[model samples]
Target: MGRKVTVRDKILETAATLFYNQGYVQTGINQIVAEADIAIGSLYKHFKSKNDLLYSYLEQEDIRFFTTVEEKLAQKKTPREKLMAYIDFRIDQQKTGNCTGCHFIKINAEIGRTDDEVQQLVQKHKEKQKNLIKKLVTEIQPSKNNFDAKQLTEMIFTMIEGGVVAATINGNTRSLEDIKKLADKLI
Candidate 1:
């Protein structure tokens, strides 16, 4: 017989889905327990509180996002190709996921100000993303005369974030496509 899924795993999985689909604040422990088909005691045993659960969820999201991106980027040869691949990946994510507008962005907007841990997590994620872009930009432009990798990294990051917000609002990939075109020009 197959091993049964742990209650903790079930709660985390259910919370991830609900938190991603429904907003974080909109999802409650009771709802997670009900959806996960686990007892409240089981949830409390795994996570002391909702904040702890959120932390775990954020960690899971970070790992999943970076792992997926690294795997996709590994397929590209040149830095330019890698950069473009990132843009394409973001666009595809929005298209495939029905344009949820970025889990980090949504969570940050919801709890960043009030929750220091969540805010830090969001900041770290953004910094990592910017660093990746900076590495690629350096390879492509190499900080030559009048070319600033840091500035370009920030610009590209902002464009991508804006594109995601626009896509979510417009319910189409036009914004992401526009960003990709702009990135192509910049790169």
Candidate 2:
């Protein structure tokens, strides 16, 4: 039998959908309460404020993103293969339109700098991603190394993020494909 969803789950699900699809500032607490089918007091019980909810949503995304990445990377044996797998996973996500671009970026663009907590969460999420990529870069063989690991990490990270932004704006994955090629050349 399936487990029942908690009031917290309902609130988070509703808020995540609304925040990602609609801008964070545009999605009101009332809408989340109504869509979640929960009482106003219930939301407050789980989250102190809308900002608190946004932080929870971002934290959730961070965990989900890395879990998926770990699963994808595990399928590959070598570090190079693992890095390529990550890029390919990103490309597939964009191609399938399974996501509406990166939620972290979308939320950050909406209100990251204004909210110190959100800003820190975004920074932490990005740093975690960069560090993971850097680890993969450092593990690759010397023959494949075209640039220093640090430089390569920055390039690959920038390419992945820039490609996502371009693909999101153009409604196509061409930029992502190009990014994959460029990354393939560098590493």
lDDT scores of the candidates, listed in order: 0.89, 0.88
For residues 7-80, could you state the per-residue lDDT of candidate 1 as single tens digits?
Answer: 88789889989988998999999999999988899999999999999989888888888899999999999999
After superposition on all CA atoms, what RMSD does each candidate show versus the true structure? 2.1, 1.5
What lDDT score goes with residue 138 in model 2?
Answer: 87
lDDT of 2 by residue, 12-70 (tens): 98999899888898999999999998889999999999988998999998998899999
Alpha-carbon error at 142 in model 1, in Å?
A: 5.8
